[model samples]
Target: MTTETKPLALTVNGRPVGPVDVPEGLMMQDFLHEYLNLTGSRMGCGQGICHACTVIVEGEGGALREMRTCITGAHWFAGRTVVTVEGHARHDAKGEIVLSPVQQAFIEHFAFQCGYCTPGFVTGATVLIDRLKRKPVARAELEQVVTEALDKHICRCTGYVRYHTAVRDLILATPGLVSG
Candidate 1:
C-alpha cells in the first residue's frame, strides 16, 4: 500500500516550518526530527509516559501547555505555535546560546545526569513557572504546587531534587510568583 502525504505546517521555536508534505500518520517528534531537523524534543519511552518528547504548545486562551510529540500527530499541531526545548532561550547580539532562567538554574543546581530527561523536565518546569507567573502561588502552598506540577515527568537521572529546587529557587527569586 502506498502512503499518502498531507501538508504539515506550524511555527516551531519561533520559526515557520513546513507546509511540506508529511505522512498523515507522522508523529510530531518524527516531523521535528526528520522534516525540520529539530531534535531537541527527544524520543524516549515512545508511549508518552516519560514525557521526554514533550514540546510546549500554545493552548486555548493563550495558555502554554506541554504536548507529547511521541504520541501526538504532527497534523494535530497544524497552524499552531509550538516551542521545542530549543525555543526556551534567546540569543544575544553576540550569537551565543543564552539559556532561559529555567535552563540556567538547572545548570546552577546540576539538575541532570544523563540529560535524556532534562528537556522534559525543563519543559514541565517552564510550564509551571509560566502558570505561576499568571497566578501566584501561596508561599505555604509552593512546595506542594511545584511538586504536583513536575511529578509527572519521569527522570532517569540525578535530577528530581535539583530540578525541583532549581524551579523553587527561581520562583522565589522572581517577584509575583509566590505570595505570602
Candidate 2:
C-alpha cells in the first residue's frame, strides 16, 4: 500500500510558489537548492552556524524576518512567504530591472569578496533596513544594528569590517533606515 504525501504551500520571490509534496524529513535548504533551484541561499555550515542559508520570511504588517533555512524543515515554510536574493530585482514601470536599494548599496559599497556570504548578508540587511525605517538609527546605533543583523554570517575573506561598513553605509545612504 502506498501512503499519500502532504502538500505544502508557500510564496517565493513574490510569487505564489507551491503545493509541492516534499518528504516529511526534507530540510528547507535541500528543497530550496536541490529541488527549487533557488541557490542564492547557500549551505555553508549546514548546521546553521554560518548563516549562509538565510532567507527573509514575509511577516505580518509588511515586516521581513531573516531565518536560517538550513536547519529548518520544509514544513516550517508551509503557508509562509520567503524572499531570497533572486527577488531583489523587479521590473520598474519602464520595464527596466530595478534593483532594491539594499542590493544597489551592496554593489556600490563593494560589500563582498569571495561572494559566498553576500546573499545572507544582503537578505538580513534588507530585513533590518525595513525594521529600522521608522526609527532612523544613529551612527553609534549603526554598529549595533549591523552586528545584530549580520552576527550569523561567517566570512573569511572580506572580514566583518567591510561587511559592517557596507551595512552602515547602506543605512546612512538611505535616510530613515538606521535608529538612534
Candidate 3:
C-alpha cells in the first residue's frame, strides 16, 4: 500500500505555489532557501530577533508585519500569500518590469552597505508604504514608522541611518503615498 501525503497550497510572488508533500517541521526558511532558492531572506539570529528573515505575508497592513520564516513551519503557509525580496521587481501586466518604489529609493539612496539586511528592509518598507498609503503619516511620524518597521533588522555595517534615510526619502518623494 502506498502512503498519500497531504498537500499545501500558497501563493508566492503572485504565483500559486505548492501541493508537494512537505515533511513535518520543515521551516519556512529552509523551504525558501533550499527548496525555492529564494536566498534574499537571510538567516540571522535564527530566533526572529534580527529580522533578517523577514518576508511579507499577504493581507497584512501598515505595521510592517512579517513572518519569521526561520521558525515558521511550511504547513503554516497553507492558503496564505507570501512575498520575498526576490519579488520586489515583478513584471507588470504589459510584461514590463517594475521595481517597487521602495527598492528604487533604496538604490538611489545607497541604503545598504553589506547588502545582507537589504532584503528585509525592502520587504518591511514595502509593507510600511502600503500601510501609509491607506493612512497617511506625517514627517514626524516618518522616524517612528521607519524605526518600528526596521527594528528587527541588524545592519552592523550601515548603522541603519542610510536605510532610514532611504525609507524616509521614498515616503517624502511620494506625498500621495505618505504624508509630510
Candidate 4:
C-alpha cells in the first residue's frame, strides 16, 4: 500500500501555513493536528453531525463560518483562513493573551467539563457573535439564535445549559450583538 501526497496552503491562526505536501485525503483535523501541531480541534464523533471538530473558516467576503474539520479535507481549505481554539485569543500590545469575550464568558460560566467539545462551541459562538454584529438578532429571538448556532455541537459533560447561558450572556454583554 502506498500513500500519495498533494500540495496544500492555508492561513491558520493569523499565520501563513504550508504550500507543503499533505497526504491525499487528509482531513482538516489531521492537517491541523499532525501537520501543524495544532491540537485544539478535537475529534469527537468524526461525523459532521457532532461538530466537535468545528473550526472557524473565513469566507472570501470576510464572513466567518464554522466547519467540521473531521469530515472536511485539507485540500478543501486551500487558500482559506482558519482559526482554531488556540487562535481565539486576542493579543495585546505586550503580546499577552486576551481572551475573546465568548471565551471569557465560557470561563466565567464554567461551560465545560472534559472540554472535548469546547473548541467547537467556542468557534461556533464566535461565528454567531460575528454574524450578529453584521445583522443583529432581535432580543426576543436571541435564544433561538443561540440555539441554532450551537445546536450541532455535542458536549457530554455539561448539559449545554452552561454553554447556552455563556453564549447568551456574551451576546447581551457585547454591544450591537442584539437589536433593540
* Per-model lDDT: 0.91, 0.83, 0.81, 0.90
Winner by TM-score between candidate 3 and candidate 2: 2
Task: Give me candidate 2's TM-score against the actual structure.
Answer: 0.89
Residue pair clashes in candidate 4: none
Winner on TM-score (2 vs 4): 4
**Model 4, residue 3: what's the lDDT?**
86
- State the lDDT of candidate 3 residue by residue for 74-167, as single tens digits: 7888888888889779688999989888888888888887888788788888888878878888767778878987877788785588889888
TM-score of each: 0.96, 0.89, 0.87, 0.96
Query: Tens digits of per-residue lDDT for model 4 on 1-180?
Result: 888999998999999998999888999999999989999999988878888889999996889988999999999999999999999888899998999988899999998888888888999999999999889999999999999889888888855999999999889988888887
Off by over 4 Å in 4: none
**Per-residue lDDT of 136 in model 1:** 94
Score residue 128 of candidate 3 by CA lDDT. Answer: 84
In angstroms, the error of model 1 at 124 is 0.6
How many angstroms is residue 128 displaced in model 3 relative to the true structure, after the best TM-score fit?
Answer: 0.7
lDDT of 2 by residue, 5-91 (tens): 578889888788678888777888988888789999988988989888889998887788888988998889999999988888799
